[model samples]
Target: MPVSLTIIPELNLVHIIYSGQVTPKELFEETQACYQRPEYKPGMAEVSDFFQVTSFEIGYDEVHEFTSRSKSTHGGVDIGTDICLVGSTKVSEPAILMYEGMIAAKEIPIRLHVLPGYPEALAVLNLPEDSLKYFPEGCHTERHLL
Candidate 1:
């Protein structure tokens, strides 16, 4: 299936939901399409809700292309990412390492909520706990519950 992308303004983040069936380039295009919308604004961070991601590949070239394109198109906005959840089961060490490396190399700070569900992700993201009144728990996923 084609990846789904959503931008949450309150959190200043972009959420990408994808199934491994799609290529990273396809997903990239979909995300770019969303940013092309006049209503879409450059977010400070990105969250890849791989909860449904079955399988995929993202090499250095793809990463560089995506970030460079985003920076140029989004008014020089930097990109940070949260990829704590993507598959149907537990996250793999290699995947985690890859994400960690990406975040480090890109120099973009990201938050990883190892809890089983989304609530924990929000907590790790440092969203105001008391401000839960202001932000709903929609973004919380099962991965955060771990």
Candidate 2:
């Protein structure tokens, strides 16, 4: 299956769901399409679920380009990844490298989060599961006073 990217501005997050069948090139293309919306500016933060990815790595050039573009177009970027059994074991290493690359190239801060799963990712975003009362299977249904 092709990778899919979902951006939820209201939640201030971007979610990338990959099926492990696509190449990084395809993934980046899809990501660009998702962010091409006029309303999407630079500085958007995102969370990625690579649970379905069989194996992957971000090359140095790719990392530099991504971080540079994000910083120049957006204010900064945060990338969160699932650290469960199916995700990246070298998550922290890449995250730090990407962050440093971004800082050095564009002076942008790229934040990284290594989460166990969706619930943990949401928790890191402060959108805990307890916040909702009746959301769908993976959504928060709790009511909040906005």
Clash number by candidate, in order: 16, 13
lDDT of 1 by residue, 1-146 (tens): 55877666777656666655556678678977877866576544555555555555666566666655544554344453343443334433344455456555655444444334455545666665442333324543333343
- Alpha-carbon local distance difference test for all models: 0.54, 0.54
After superposition, candidate 1 runs with Cα above 4 Å error: 10-12, 70-75, 78-96, 108-116, 126-146
| Model 2 Cα lDDT, one tens digit per residue, 25-90 | 875788778778765545555666655565445666776766665555554335422211114445
| TM-score for each candidate, following the candidate numbering | 0.59, 0.63
Q: Where is model 1 poorest over a 10-residue stretch in terms of lDDT?
A: 131-140
Most accurate candidate by TM-score? 2
Overall local distance difference test of candidate 1: 0.54
Off by over 4 Å in 2: 39-44, 76-86, 90-106, 130-146
Question: What C-alpha lDDT does candidate 2 achieve relative to the native structure?
Answer: 0.54
